[model samples]
Structures are given as C-alpha cells and as structure tokens.
Target chain A: MAGSHSLLDLTAHALAEEIEAGEVSAREAAEVANTRIGEVEDEINAFVTTTPGLALERAEAVDARNGGRNLWEGVPLVVKDVLSTRGVRTTCGSRILENFEPLYDASALRNFGDDLIVVGKANCDEFAMGSSTENSAYGPTRNPWDLGRVPGGSSGGSAAAVAAGEGWWALGTDTGGSVRQPAALCGIVGLKPTYGRVSRHGLIAFASSLDVVGPMTRDVRDGALLLQAIAGHDPRDSTSANVEVPDYLTNLEDGVEGLRIGVVPELMGEGIEPGVREVAERVASGLEGAGAEVGEASLPHSGYGLPAYYIIAPAEVSSNLARFDGVRYGLRVSADGVHEMYRKTREEGFGAEAKRRIMLGAYALSSGYYDAYYAQAQKVRTRIIEDFQAAFARYDVLLSPTAPTVAFEIGEKVDDPLAMYANDICAVPANLAGIPAISVPGGLSEGLPVGVQLMSDHFTEPTLLRAARATEQVADFRYQMKP
Target chain B: MISEEQVRHVANLARLGLTDDEIEKIGGQLDAILDSIEKIRELDLADVPPTANPLDLSNVLRPDGPRPELSQEEALFQAPERVEDLFAVPRID
Candidate 1:
C-alpha cells in the first residue's frame, strides 16, 4: 500500500516508463489508482461509477501478454461519462439515461488499445449543459482545492479526479469551455483539440459542430502523450480530420525562442478578476522572457463569442437531444398515447437546466425566429472565425485567462443562466474557429488556482504544446489538494 | 420579454411537459438571456455566408458493403421496455 501511494506522485509519462521497465506491474498501477479513488471519491464526487474489476482484468491481460510494449501500457485513466464505454453504465450526469450502457466503445477510447486500463467514468453536467457540475442529477462534484467551491463543468468530474490523483489522466469533451474552465479551476492541464482532431463517434453529443474530445492531466507533457494516443482520423466519424497526426512529444521540448505570441487586450478587460489578470500578465512576461516576441493583438468579434455560442450550441442541442424520446433506449414514461409518452418521459427524465436549453433551442429554431437568431448567430460565428484567421496572420499563438474568476461556491451561479454563461467568454472562441487550445495551471490567486489559456491555428497542437511547456517551466506552480 | 404563453408553446414544440410554475420561471430567464444575446443584431454582416462547419469537407459517403453490425439482443440491451426483438412503447391511437 505504501509503494502504491508513492506512484500517485508520478506523472502519467513517468508511471508508464516505470511499468515498461518492469519496476511496477500493470496490476500494481491499477491497484494504486483504485486506492486513490477509494481515498478521495467521497470528498471529491469525481466519478459516477468506478470499474475496478474491468481495470484489473485488463491490467492482468497486459501483464500476461505484451507487458508495457506500448506507450500507454498499464496507465490507469478515467473517461468522462459522456463517452460510451461498452457494458459500463455511462450517464452524462442526467437522470434521463441513468441506467444507460452502450454496446460499443467510443472511437477515441478504441484508439487506446489494450494497454490503457479504464479505471472509471467521471461525472459531468447533465447532458453536458451548464458551467458547473451542480447541474448533475447526482450531487455536484466539489473542487478538491476548496470543498465549498465547485470544480467547473461540464467536465468537473474529470478535472477533479485528475487534480486529486484519482487517476493519472482523464478524457473530457469540451463544448465551449467545459474542459478548460474546469481544468483551470482544479489547477490541472486540459486541452481542447481542433474540432476534428479526435473522433467523436460514440460521444453523446451536446452540440455537434462545437464538441471535441480533449485530455486533462497533471502536467503538459502527460497531456501531449495522451493526445498522441487518441488523436487521428476515423472513418466512423466523417468529421474526424484526415490530416497527418504528428508525434507531439517529438517537438514538445523545443523551446519557444522565436515564436510570436499575442495577448488579447479585450480578454483582460472589465469582467476579469484582478488575480486572474495578474496570472495572464505573468504568463505573457514569461513568454517574452523566454525570447519570444510578445505584442498586443485584437479579435474584435470575440466579445460576441458567448452570446453566439449560447444560441448555436442550444440550436444543436435541441436537434441532438430529440433522440432521447421514449421510443428508443434510455428512460421511458408510460402513457396512453405515444406523443404523451414522449412528453411525460422527457418531463420526468430531464433536469431543469436540460429542459431550459432544449426549450431555448426550440424557440430559436422555430420558423419566424430562425433567420433572426440561429442564422444570424451562424453569421457572427463566421466573423469570429475570420477574426482569428486575421490574428493568426500576425501571431502564431494567443494567450488569455481561462476564466474570469476562480471556482465559485456550488450554488453561486446555478440560478442565473447568463452569469453561468459568462464563464465561457474566454473559452468559446477557440471552439468557434475550430482551433486547438490548452489551459495550463497559472499561479494561484487568493489561494485558488488560475489557468492561463494558450491557443493556436488549426492542426497546430505541436506548437501550442511547445509554448505551454516553456511557460509551464517558468511559472512552475506546484499543484496540490487536501482531501 | 418572452411571455409564459410563449414559453409554454416552446415547451410543447420541444415535446417537454413543463409545469405552470416552471413555465413562469423559465419565461423570465429566457427573456433576460435573449435580451443580452440581442446584441448580435448590431453587426452589419449582410454579405458573409454562414459557416455550419469549420471544415469544408463535402460528400462524406461510406462504402456500401457488408459490415459488422450490432446484434439484435445487444441493440436492445438498454431499452427501458422491450418485447421480443422490438422496443415497446405506448399505443399511438
């Protein structure tokens, strides 16, 4: 038990290397992760379900067969409940599908091969809506940093689990700021890859166009290693990019010497907390100190990002969520008529936030309102994309504070949807333009962690990771959580 | 501002049976949200084409051939109610 406890201090990359060298067996790594989960699950509420038997079965298989031939061999990891894991109850923190289990694995999970052990499913916001995991039908996931405060969502469970060392790393789906904002609050590394960089075949959709699979980890290097294992094209998901996947670790150590970095003045404006702004400034200065050219840049349409995202994402949500009626799988309510069955089932199954988004989406897509709301939002989305294109012409990467404030109390923003939506102001633009963005733990403020967001052009995760690595070394904020 | 009637209509269109209290509450919330998002109208984007997708790929048709498919039992595994090989639901008439 003492030996297993020490393994928690190592990064996923170091743990993999140890397992490969036979100093640690696959079963030992799984046991350590299970121990960590047992220690922290109640305080953190990071997982909806834990799969120790499945993890141990897979670990024993790896030990008997290849024995750490692959990069991720014996690495215990958690998957956000939004991803389908065959035979494991995958709930997107919604009562609608509380008992739902998929028959197949997500394409991204399929890419992990035989070596990566699936430790558990992380909790998230119901149907991946809302900025805090308070929307979860299961109780909210508490921030490991402060029990009273929330771990940001809809990927809160994944971030908290990683922060508390429940697993070496975990996967989260980011639509808007779900992944980055949560990672920022928990003081870990989260990357939202370019829209099609990873396949979304078995991910239950929140917003189809904006959703992307990303990795959350303790450090930037582990994030890169996990991305290497999961990213690439899949015929199963037509939206998956067919471009060449680069070896992310190859150029990860390459310092940010001559790279051009842009600091958006707009992001540091009114709503940003002073502490968060100070961290962004420190990251900018750190980059400049590393010999990179830094200057102020502007993306004018970014101010519209939150408003546009709220419309477009809900518009898609209304369409994607229509599949959960009583006719198919998931929860069903019995009524005399079929139509009444759908209505009653949905009324009973969905939570308040899920109903709100669905209704908002329906109103936006209704006949007379389509051109004014949905189509207009799409036009604004185009302008936001073009604005990024213009900025990328002058700079290689842009930096901003991941969220306006640190993690708030669990019930703080739950009642005000607009206030909750504001959390994604700095995050939604990357999703809008289909670019790669990552959140690295910036220095803490008032004893709470702040995240510095780094974004780059499409398919440029290598450069983004490189810049993040350099900034990470300079800031060097130690991440810790008391259970 | 969106009236409770409009919210009720939207709930009907979306096939959700929201209570009167929920309708009154959601109506006020939607009004505030829409009022803020209404700022999108100020932009003069007459000529810009809407981008439904960032990637411009078209015609993503898969090969038409025999392939592995989920078995009937596996497909019906998660059904809330099932009879034989079919998902059971309420009577239409």
Candidate 2:
C-alpha cells in the first residue's frame, strides 16, 4: 500500500531515487502495482486485460537496464484497450475485436516501453463511441469515488484505475470528452494535448480527426509528465504534428501570474448543475487569487458543438470503422455466402451504439445526403475552429465545466442517446478545433468530483499546464479521492 | 427514406451480419440518428471543401522503405478458424 497513490501522485523523482539506489526493483514496483490492481480492480471494473506476468517481466528488464532511463523509470501504467499493444488483446470494448490480439504496438505504447511498466489495457466504451462508460461491452467501470456512480467514458476505465490508485498513470484516448470528462468525474487529472501532438498510429480509429491519445493521472504534474513522455511525431500517423516535447515537469514550477484566463459565460449558465457552477467559480476565483487576470469570454458557437460533433464524428466513425467487416481481419461470421458472413459478423460484433454511428455516418456520406449533411458539417467545423481561434487570441486559456453534471447512476443516460451526447459540451470543442486542454479537479458536486478545463491553442500545453497548475494550487484537491 | 432494405445494404457494405430482428431494431435507431443529421441540411454551406482534419497538415512523411509486415502466423492468430496460414472461411463455391 506504500506506493498506492495515483500513479501520477507517487512523486516520480522519489520513485526514481529508490529505483536508482536499488531500494526498489522495477519488478518490485510492478508487483506492488499489480497487487493494488488485484485489490480494487474488481470493484471498479477498470481493466480489459491485466497483463500481470508480462508486466513483472518487463519491470525486471527495466531495473536491469537502470542506467538507461527517463523520468518515469519503474512507474506502473495502463494503456487503454483502444491502443494496440503487440501480442496483447486490444479489444476496444467491442465484440468484433473481442478476441483480437494486436500484432503491433501503438506508437505511444511502443515509446512507453522504456523505464515504464505497462500494467495492462484499461476498459472503454465500445470503439470509444459514448460519453459514459456504461456502453462498454466489457461492463461499465464504476467511479472509484462512489461505486454506484458512472465514470466518464470512453476513457472511464483508465481514469477509474488512476483514481483508484491501480497504477501511477494511464493512457486514455479522447475522441470527444473520453479522457477529460472521466478524469473530472473520477477526481483525477487528464490532459488532451494539442491535436496531432501525440501519434495516433495503432490507436483503433474512432473518429480519427477527433481521437487523441493523452495521459490521465492523479494531478497536473503526473499528467504533464506522462504527456511529455507519450507526445511526439510518428511517421505512421500522417496527421501527427512534428513538435518538440516540452519538459512538462520542469515547466510546472512556473506560477500563472498575469496570465489571461477566460471563463466561457455559456458554460456557467443554466443546464450546468449549481454545484458544478460553484466549483467552476471557485476555480476561477482560485486562479484570480493567484494573480492571474480572469475575464468573461463568450463563445456563442459552443451551443452548436454537440450537434456539429455528432455529425462530424459519426461521419468519420462510419468511414474509419468500415475496416472491421468480417473479411481479412477481425470477427468473422459465416453462413452460406460472403455477404451473410459480413452481416453475421457485424451483427454479433457491433453493439447498439456502434451500429447507430455506422449507420448515421453511412447516411451522411451517402450520395443523396453528402452535400447537405457531411459538407455542411465540415463548414460548421471550420466555423467552430474560427471561434476557438478568436477566443484564444483574446485569452491565454479558456475555462469551462468539464461536464455539466457529476456522475449519474449507471444506465441513467444509456437509454437516452441525446442526454449521453450532451455530457461532452465542455470538452468536445477542443477536439473539434484541435487544441490542447487539461481537466483538473475543481471541487465536489454532491461528493462527486467536478473538472475545470483549461484549454489553449495548438501546441500551447505549457501555457495550459501553467494555468491548470495555478488552479490546482487554489482548488487543493490533489488527493481528493483516496483508495 | 431508409428502410430495412437500406439497412441490409449498409450491413453488407460494412461487412456486418445482422439478423432480421437486429436489422429491424437498428433500422429504427439509424432512422433517429439520421433525423438528427438531417438538421445539418438546413445550414447553407456554399463552396466549402470537406475538411478531414481541423489542422491543415498534409503529406506527412512515412519511412520511404517497406516495413516488415506481420508473419502469416501472427496475422492469422486471432481468426477463429485458420488453415495452412490462411484464414479459413465457409466455402463460397
């Protein structure tokens, strides 16, 4: 139980000391972390695959090569199921990929090998489709703070694991609000780096343009450290940006003074729970108290984000997920002919949400509707980008409630698709516009955590983290939920 | 209007097998989702090119040589049925 804090909470510098002095072997760290997972994972349903044996073996190897290390040596971590880890099952919480063992590692997972131990694959919404973890075929990951409450999805499992102290940190993919929203719900920190900052190679495509791999940890420091580790360009991902990985841990000591922080007026307005608004306001006051210039910024275009995202995301989901047909790869169901095989495979493989998105996407991309639906949605995307650009030009960072409400009961929004979709109101704009955003615990709403988002323009993670760190100092809930 | 026939057509395109019940069920859900998408039809988008990525980067460099692919064994490891290193399927002939 000694190392049982959010993987991000372990103070990597201290862990590195023990590992360096032979006080702790990487194998020992891996065992400790795996034991922690064993203790609490069942209550949280946070893992799709816990590769304990491989994790221990890899940890031993890291200790053996102790001299060659990065900041995160001997740190235990989890990769979300959506990322392909070579020779390990990467189910993406879909029956289609249920038994599929990836032949290659995602670019981030491959780079994560040095010094760090990959504990296992975290659970997720089927193909990263929904806003709540309830959609996962594997079963919803319960929010560690309150087991009956939902953990935000599709990165819920990763967020829940980190919140439950199962690992030092975990990698999560945010297509809409997958990473940040769950982190908020679970009272942890998650960062959605500037679009293209992290390579998407081997991350099972889910709305490719919106999908970004990021780190979820106990606090901003670990979030930033993990971001620094996993972020960079990969040739395999055509959209990956060629950007320098900033030393995020070194940069966090800088306080957010005289920095311009904008509070979007619409976010704090009606529909945002009163408790959530209070926390968001406290975060703002906390930032202002830290000598940062806080101002009210209006983004009228935000009201349209849900509709625009639904169209654009599903349109991409329709095309990107087209690869899962029962053909050369994935689940194959066969009958008399090839067509029936495709039908049977998809029918059994895809869950309801996946089917809905595929159909919606196909409809938008179809000939009769292409001009009116997909074409118009692209233009709206352009407009949303312009709106964010304008906001960033006037403000250093944009702040909003990560979700309008806290974790609802499981199966609450599952039947109501629109209510499930609306939960990403605060987080989706960044993905649509391709910006960097971080969610830090604001406060609690009826004992459930709330996240205040700090968003900045492309490649401005340094500024985003500075603002988030400043907010973190004032909010002071770094260890709000202890396992 | 998209009917059960269109759903069947799309299921084939996506290579997913659907039962009569599933097709009937999904047909309704798809109808609702498409109805929401139909809202986009109201927007006046003139001379707008379809945007794939919000960031305008193109022609990202790839390693200019062939990368080794997975061996036949690794490739077929997850298939429910396989024979002679090829995925075995129900005979079409």
Candidate 3:
C-alpha cells in the first residue's frame, strides 16, 4: 500500500498492465483508488456509495485468477448510479430509489467480467434529467479543478471522480450531453458511442431513443479501452446492436492525415463564449497542422437541436418514469387509497426538476398538444439527422466546442432552467443523430477546461477514436486538479 | 404563457401531487422554456417523416425460448411492500 498512492496517476490501461505484470497487486490498486476517493469525496461529493469490501473481494479474485487475458483485468472503475448493479444500492441521485438495490447487474457491468473492480456508484442528476448535478436529490458534484464550480452533469459524479483520480475510469450514460459535457468541464475524455452500439439493458431510461452508455476516462486511450470492454450486443436489450465489436486500441494510433474534419459553423457562433471559441479555433488549427483537412461544414438544423431535445427527451421521460409508481418497488408513501398513494409517493419521492419534466412531458403528450409539441419535435429530430448525414457526405468527421462555455459556478444556473439547459447545445446533435462523438480537452479558458468535440458517422468509432487520439496528442492539455 | 391551472392539470395527469407554490413556479418556468423551443415551429416540416428510432431497426424479435429468470424471492427483494409472493399495493376504492 505504500507505493499504491502513485497508482492513481496511471491510466486504467497502465494500471491493468502493471497489475498483470506483477508490478502491482489488484488490491493495492483498489486501495490507492479507495484512498483517493476518501481524500476527495468530502470535497467533490462524486460517489453516492462506496463498496470497499466488494472491491477488495473482487481485487483478490483478480490476483487469484490464472492469466490476465481480459483487457480490464485488475482495473478499478466507478459506475454511474444510473446503471443497475445487483445488490448494490443504485440511487440514480433520487430519494425515490434512495435504498433500492437491483437484483441484476447491467449488461455493461457484467461485460467487464469479474476483472474490473467497481469502487462505488457515482452520483448523478435525478433520473438523468438535468444539465447540472444540482438537480441531484443527494447534492451536486463539484468540479475537481475548482470546487466552487460544477462538474457538468447528469454524469457529473463520474467525470469528477475520474478527474480527481478517485477511480481509473467510470461508466456514464449520455442522453443529450450527460457524458461529454461533464468530461469537457472536468478536463477528461468522454465518448458517447453510436446509439445501439452499447447495450442499455440495466441503464435507467431517460430518453430511450437517445440514451447511450459511455466511458469517462483520464485519457483518450483509456476511453477507447473502456469502450472496447462494454461495447457489443446483449440479448436482454432489444435495441442493442448486433454489430461486431472492433479492437478499439488497434487503430487508435492511426493518425488523422487526409481525414476531412468538418467544423459546424452554427455551433461556433453566437451564444458560445469567446474563450471557448478561441480554444476550438486552436484545435481546428492543430488538426490542420497535423495534416487533417479541417474546414467549415454547416448543419442548418443544428440551431434547433436543443429545442427538439427538450421536447423529445421530456416526452420519453414521462413514459419511462411511469414505472416508478408506488405499486412495485422504490419509495412508497401510504395514503387512504391507491390513487392517493400513487400521487403522494411521487410528490414526496421526486425532486423539483423531476416533477417539472414529468409535468412538461405529460402536457406535450396530452391529446391535443401531442401533434404541436411531441410530433413537431420528432420531425425536427429527423431534420437534425438529415443535416448531419448531408454534412457527413462531404466530411469524414465533424468538430465543435463540447459546450458553449467552461464550467460555471455551482449555483449560477440552478435557478434558471433555460440557462442550465443551454450547457448541452453543442453536444446534443451527435446524440440526436445517433453517431459516435467524443470530448477531448481542448485547452483552458478563464482557468477552466474547454472541450473540443469530434463526431463521426455511425459505427465508425475507429475513425473517431483515431482522430480524437491525434487531437489529444496535439492539444497535450494535462488534467491537473489543485490540492 | 402556461397558466397555473394548466400546470396543475398536467401535474394531475402525471400523478404527481404539487403544492400551490410549485404549480406557480413550474408554470412560469415552463412558459419560458416552451417559448425558447417554439422556434422549431418556424420550419416547414410538412413533408418530412418523423424518426422515432435513428437506427431504423425493425422487427427486433428474440427467439421464444426458456431462459433464466429471477426467482420469486429475488423479484420481491426490493419491493416496498410485499404480501407473500406478490407486491402489495394500497387498496383501490
């Protein structure tokens, strides 16, 4: 345990290699991660619950196993609370399921196959509804770089944990911009694979059509490794793609020469912060200098992505969340009758944003308004997809700022829902289009990190990861959290 | 702008009991958000087909076969209230 503290500095890949080579024991790596979590948990509030006993038990098993053939053998990971882990309390950052323990593990977690040690469950927005972790019923997760700022959400805790070195890597689900936006703010790498590319068997639904299980890691290579472990088909999930899983690390070093990178002009203009825009410009020039052909590509419907997302996401949310009624599991408030029990249970269980969204979604899907709101949003979503397809016809990949601005003060946008929702504008297009996209540390602006986003056609993660790795090298922006 | 009455109606439809203050607050907030999203109404999308699933997957049928299922004990493990082998809920009318 003496030299274990330094293990926090190594990426998940490096840590796994060290453990496999007998340079470090799996328990030692877990101890290092748990120690780091203990040091930073009070400040960042990254995890809702830590399973040190389970982690140690798994680590010992890893040490006892034959050979380290699994890529994630002995690696420490943190799973976002949104994913189900059998017997572990998965809160989804809500009081409704405060003590609810799942009976089955998510397919993604099971895919790791007893090798990766899960240190804890990362906190997130209530049912993954909000742009800031402030919507989390437990509390907000603070940015590792500046405790006063938020680690963007609804995957805020996962991003903050990886940024603070609490875990080597963390699993996060992105619906809208949950993973990439937070990773951008926390100065790490987050990749949302193409929809259906990753199984969603145990990921609690937000917007079912848009939700994707993604990885948040300290570096691009680590992100690729984690994605490789979790990406594939699952019989339990009907929507899971049957596509063959590729070796993500194989083509990762293939540089971006002759790759046509498109910069969406609409995302670069008005409402984007000047400093963040400058970082994006620098990333474009960096890619150009590295021999990638970077030029402006327009997505005319990009401006409508955020609006369409709000309508579409909330509509699905209302339907998905109806399962939380007091009849089955989770929190139940007693009343004189079943109807009153259902009403009172939800009233006491859900947080403010959750109630707001449920109401909005109900209204959108109501008899007369459905055509005006829900249908219209779906049509706009189609337009957004078509826009991306048109752009991709001319370019191999698309580029943009991950968010409109850097991390903001924790309480700054909490009161204003519109302001909080604006944080996801630059990242939602990819989710809407069902394409793979990544957020890599572009640079720092006003002392906070800015993310340069790279998006590619569906199922082209090899190209996307390769281009992102190239950008990662060129930017060379190291993640450093002040003690 | 959405009225407090409309907000209460929607909350009722969603089966959520809301306080007066919550109804008023959410009403104003929803109005502003809806106004911002109203820009989507400007486009002439008459001929465009709505896309519910971007992947365009169809007939995703799994073979009908017996597979492992959660035992009764495991299924009832997390239930807030359970009666023998079934989940217990408050009585209706």
Candidate 4:
C-alpha cells in the first residue's frame, strides 16, 4: 500500500503556494509525487516512463531559486508521452519512436522551464490515435475507480495519474476529446483550450488543425492556474494565435450570476447514457437556480462532427506521421530498397490503430477521392463552426455531457473501431469549431465519474472557466476524492 | 464497399506493409468507418468554402535570420543506426 503523504491532498496550486511561501520545499513536493507513482503505478500502469532523478533535480533547482513567477512553479507535472521532453524519452505511445529522445524541449516545456518538475511521461494511445490507451504499445492504463474500466484516452495516462494522486497535475493534448474524455472518465478537470491558445511546438501532432494542448488537474482552479502558466503565443507554431491571454484566475470565481447557459439538446439525445444526461440536466437546473438563464440551444450540425473528425484528423495524421520514415531516428527495419525500408519499418513500428488511421488518411487524400472525402469533411467542419457561431450569439456558454457515458471497461470497445470513434462525438464539435471547452466533475453514475462539459466562443476561456467553477460548486461531489 | 485491392493500394500509399490476412481484417474496418463517414456526403455543402485551417491566418513568416541551431552530434543523437557524423541506412541501388 502507498503510505499517504501530507502533500497528497494539495492541488497543484496549493502545493505551489506551499513551496512559494517556504512552507515546504519543492523537492519535497516532487518526492511525494514520485513516491505515489511507486505505490500505484504497478496497478494502474499510467506512465510510459517515470523520471524521479530528473524530477528531483528540477525540484532542487526550484528550491534553490525559491520557485518562479508561475502559480504551478515547483509543482510536479506528468507530461503525456506525446509532448517532447528533452533528454527524457517521449514516445507518443508508439513503437516507431520507442527509443526516441528529443534534442530540445518542446516550447511549452520551455515555457515552464525550472518552474514545474518533470515527474514522468504519461502513457497514451499510439500517436494519440485511439480513444483508449489500449492502442499504446506499452499498455493500457486502468481507471482508478475500477480496475477493469479504461481511463479514457489517448490522454488516459495523464488523467489517471492526476486522479490517482500520482502527480499534482499533467499535460494532455486534445485533438478530439483525447484530453476531455479521459478527464471525464477519470473525474478530474480537463480543458481543451481554443485552438492555438496554447503553443503546439512541443505537442506531437495527431491533427494539426484540431490539436490543442491542455491541462488535466484535480480541480477547475488548478486547471486555470496551469493554463495561465502555459497559455501564450509562439512563433515556432505557425498556427499559434497572436492574441492576449487573459488572466484565467481573475474571473474564475465570478459565479455564473446572470449568465446565459444553454443546454445542448442535440448532445442530450440518443447514445448519451440516461445517467450522463441526468447529471448534465441537474447541472443546468443548478445554474438556473443560481440566476443563470438555462434554455435549449441547438447545434444542428454537431451530428456530422464525428465522421468529419474521423476523416479530417486522419488526413492530418497521415501527413504528420510520414516523417517517421525508417531512415530517421527511432525504429527502422532493414530492407533491400529505401521505399521497401519505409514500408517495412512502418509496418513493424506502428501499431494497428495507427496504421488504420494512416491508411484511411491516405485513401482520403489519394487521387480521385480527395473531393469526396477530405474536401467534404472540411466543408462539414465549416458548417459545424457556423452552428457554434449561431448558438453562441444567444448563449454565453453551451452545456453538454463531456462523454456519452462513464469510463467503459477495457477490451469492451477495442475490437470495434466506430464504437471507439463514437466516444469522441460530444467533445469533437468543440474541437471542430475551435472553441474553448472544459470538463468539470458533475457526479458519479454507477459509482463512476461523469463530466459536465461547458464550451464558449474562441478565446472565451475566462467565461468558460467561470461557468465551469459554477458547475463544480453546485455539484454534490468533492475534488481529489480518489479511489 | 472498399475492395481488398484498393486497401492494398492505400496501404502502399501509407508505406505500411500488411500481410494478406491483416489486409482482409483492416479492409472491413475501413469499410465500416467509410460507411459512417459517408454521412458527410448527405449534406448539401457544395457552397461552403472549405476551411483547410481553422484560423484564417496566412503566411506567418518568421524573420529570416540565423538563430540557435543544434550541433551535428545533438541532431544525430537519436538516430536508429548512427554511422559517424551521418545517419546510415541500407545502400540503395
């Protein structure tokens, strides 16, 4: 059994406060997280790699400097395997880059240099391709709530680690609910920032257009603190927005008083479990009771979000993953010719899900089929964005269940590709529309966590987080209530 | 429905080598995924201008100047088969 440490109960922000005030040293904070990883990692299998020595070294540096300007300074952070960490291995849960170590830190990690200690690399779906970590070459991470259930992925490892108290918080990437769905399943707060809000220079790309680096934390406040630390423009990422990042902490406590909250009926309809809908409805009424106007808002084109994402994301993945040719770093297979070498190495290196997406993408972008598949999907994406624009004109924020259901058992949806893809629908529309969305713990259904998702217009993270805090406040659950 | 031959071609385009049995299984999966994605074809979206990138920004060019560059050793640090200063691969005829 993992002996409970005193720092285990503190949120990332709280731990930072302690370190900032000299109440506790940064090394102590890092050690507590490293120790917790030892106790629970054998069971949950959340991380692909753990870096206690690096974490302790960074923590000592923080202690020497008395922490930094960021609120998450000196706090232990578990980076999802998709994000590049210099020196430490960053295997995007794929065998292709199994032995790859980045030469330079990703821009986001550099943004937090010396502020956050590196705890470990959280496991994820190979190339951030699947909804469950089972697609990872390493292995799947189990839900802390139930040993048999999935910690929703491809950011499942990050979500599970934070929820299970293995780390103060972790970084996750959301191309299509990879962050929010797992955070929903794991019952921690997850935020998918408006596209380009956070720099993606360090984030391994699953889909260039839809990918947004996000934070998975124990509470919405912690998420806001972490977002404030990492949210900024970078010239390195061409798609990064050149916009001012508002202080996410300022209006976070400004309750949803007189706010216009819209309950998305489309999201509430079929496929969403009655248990998940009940919590979302209760959250709506709770907002209504608190003087926020709750009404039905329709996102008519959201139904197309799933298929469009499947098409569009894979199209991007095909292009992005092409860089992993056999001649480069990581795994390679010897063959007679260069082309054969490429084919054989990829065949050996990439897992099934990765190949599936790659093939799908290649077919979509292939000659004679581009207009039918890739172009058509892009048009659908535009319509989805228009639908959001129309809805947001009336409602301050849209409310829905983050996922259709709670954490599903492992191996339940593995064989079924569409079933795994369907898990992304509720969260996919936000990514398509390039809006900021967050998943806050609503309540438990069948003793498992359910998430209430709130979304706002692009760059409305402050408003989105304000509504999130209101939802968290009304919910009859407590943060940091781990299994 | 996608044919097995088409799947092979697509796999070839993706540079992924798959066995015949694996091709049969994966082809079915692709067919099912395509069936679902066919819903996009149902919509009358011919008039909607395609959004290749979400943001409307174009040509975000960085100032042309020499900044820090990784040395040869650092750049080739993780090569699968490193041979001296260059990355080695099978000789191509």
Best by DockQ: 3
Q: lDDT by residue for model 2 over B1-93, one digit each (tens)? A: 578888877766665566788788778776665665565556665765655687888766665787887787777766767787787777564
Runs off by more than 4 Å, candidate 2: A1-14, A114-116, A481-483, B1-9, B31-42, B47-50, B81-85, B91-93
> Across residues A173-193, which tens digit of lDDT does each residue of candidate 1 receive?
999989999999999999999
lDDT score of model 3?
0.89
Q: Single out the weakest 10-residue window by summed lDDT for candidate 1 chain A.
A: A65-74
Question: Per-prediction DockQ, in order?
Answer: 0.80, 0.53, 0.85, 0.80
Stretches of candidate 1 above 4 Å error? A1-5, A114-116
Off by over 4 Å in 4: A1-5, A114-116
Which candidate would rank higher by lDDT, 1 or 3? 1
Candidate 3 versus truth, CA RMSD in Å, comes to 1.3
**lDDT value, residue A289 of candidate 2:** 88
User: Using alpha carbons, what is the TM-score of model 2?
Assistant: 0.94
lDDT of 2 by residue, A108-162 (tens): 8665573347888999999988877787789888988888888889899998888
Pairs in steric clash, model 3: none
Q: Kindly indicate the candidate among 2 and 3 with the higher lDDT.
A: 3
Candidate 1: deviation at residue A221, Å?
Answer: 0.5
lDDT of 4 at A92: 97
lDDT of 3 by residue, A92-128 (tens): 9999999889877889877667455789999899998
